[model samples]
Target: MRRKLTLKDIARELGVSISTVSKSLKNSEEIGRDTKEKVQAFAKLYNYKPNNIAVSLKNKHTKNIGVIIPDIVHYFFTTVFRGIEKYANSLGYNVIICVSDESFDKEVINTELLANGSIDGFIMALSGETQLKNDYRHLTEVTEQGIPLVLFDRVTDEIKCDKVLLNDTEIAFEAVSKMIKAGRKKIALLTTENFFNVSINRELGYRKALEEHGLAVNENLILRLPFNEQIDGIYPFVSNNEIDAVLAVNEIFAIHAMGILQSKGMKVPEDISFIGFTNGLLSKYASPPLTSVAQHGDRMGELAAKMLIERIEMNFVEGKEEDFRTEIIKGTLIERESTVN
Candidate 1:
């Protein structure tokens, strides 16, 4: 292996002190422009990369924000990350992403890992286990230390901080209404998990819409798994039931429902028109294109990043730091063949 290059190497090459090389690389005003340019060129030629960790230590900024999620492989979360990465990069910042895989203990450890100046702020969605455990002392610890944070999607009301959320209840109502309009009468609600307030909000929307349409709300139709967990039993149960249509709380359950229904000799749209939320990539690529509630994931991410950055700047300035701010991003309906008339 080749020996790595360093600032000392640049200093040796430039016939100057390492301190001069340091100030020049940092673009400090004390260094003359000609000298600074010469040092920078040498450093670049030698492929000398400044240590971000050292830079962060000196400036008290990682220019890196922490993001915690249950799973990065999920289509919805991936889309959200795409949005976040784009915005974070455009603003000269990086993201320190961590996955807890729905483990409450893991989430706490990840949050604590970022607390020691490793991240300037945080933008995240709560892990499924974190919500179940309902332990938010870690979140509050970051906030109390004056670290900026913006919670999105799976945020809890217990934590008093800035948040960017979708109008889950309204969209849920619309999903149900769309199914009804498409001539599907029995719309079953399938959720992946149960502890999230957002999921509850979406379920409430389903009920509110069903009631508004003068349709009797059927308790038997709502199937919530323990811990809001997913199960293979749902496939056969859905096949045996007289379910005409389904309003999956999110895309994963919705796509899975379609497969289960088809396996039982049911044709989509002809047998049951469906509408899934999240407008995730899978929804568009499903055997039959899925009509969906396009949760502006990119918009959610941008909004969350903007909020956290603003809060960080605020805390760095004004010093008022008393009240927390709350905000919501609106979701849109994306019509597709899943509910074709």
Candidate 2:
């Protein structure tokens, strides 16, 4: 069986730029007749069908950007959206948003819905189910047809596009190291499943901090939980593990763990210390307040919007392909009452 070809595949095989292939496929007069014939012939042989939505959106400047997020209620995602809206609106671009609800089908449907000439480009974070499935054909299709895309937070390497991200591993390392410095041992890590890129990086940082500090990484102390579900297993995990400090990948997990441990008669900062990622309201309002790693989601969103808009407004240089880039935002540790001073 022959694999379906994308514009990128056809361009690579024909030794031409993607722009040239795209124009050739459309039979634009700018491409030489011979080159056009060759590109079309190759595309025909491979049964390449251009995405109709992308074709309609091409060269039509809608001056609107589509933003898709995994969860609408998530503090980090909301902050990111605020930044994107502020920057994009300043530049005369309207922002349209859709929530994927962490479902792969919902994400794909949202992409399709937004791509139907409703917007000029897209800014998105991969949904948990999309990342778990590892299927990016929908995203690849949009890019293959000359649409600009910028991924933020939960991004993947499979898609070659502009991206904005936090330094998850480094920040997690800093958070764990701070706990160790405060004379805390038997540190436990609360994280999501390994499929999520950010979780995997955070776990790496957690392990690195422990190993570098002459402490062994204990698998039994690492608790894995579902990303978008009701909190469970926290009590049992806390009961089973003799941990002096805890580092959760997100604020919800950290706050929930703190509540459970406190109810079990463990005192915050005295009996146990806690740190989590995303310095959101929940962290700030928790009974003892929580120390957290601030991801700076607003700044990330602004950068992502800038990258996507720049790509959307860039003039095509005939036969040249644009180089994609990944921008990393540095995270800061917000010290609060949950940790020992």
Q: Please list the residue runs of candidate 2 whose C-alpha ends up more than 4 Å from where it truly belongs after superposition.
A: 1-59, 316-320
The lDDT of each candidate is 0.83, 0.91
Could you give candidate 1's per-residue lDDT for residues 91-198 as a string of tens digits? 998989999888888888999998888899988899888898898999999888888888889999888888888999998898788778766778888865568878
Clashing pairs in 1: 193-228, 194-228
- Per-model TM values vs. the true structure: 0.89, 0.82
Q: After superposing candidate 1, which stretches have Cα over 4 Å from the reference?
A: 1-19, 25-41, 44-48
Q: How many residue pairs clash in each candidate?
A: 2, 0
- Candidate 1 weakest lDDT stretch, 10 residues: 225-234
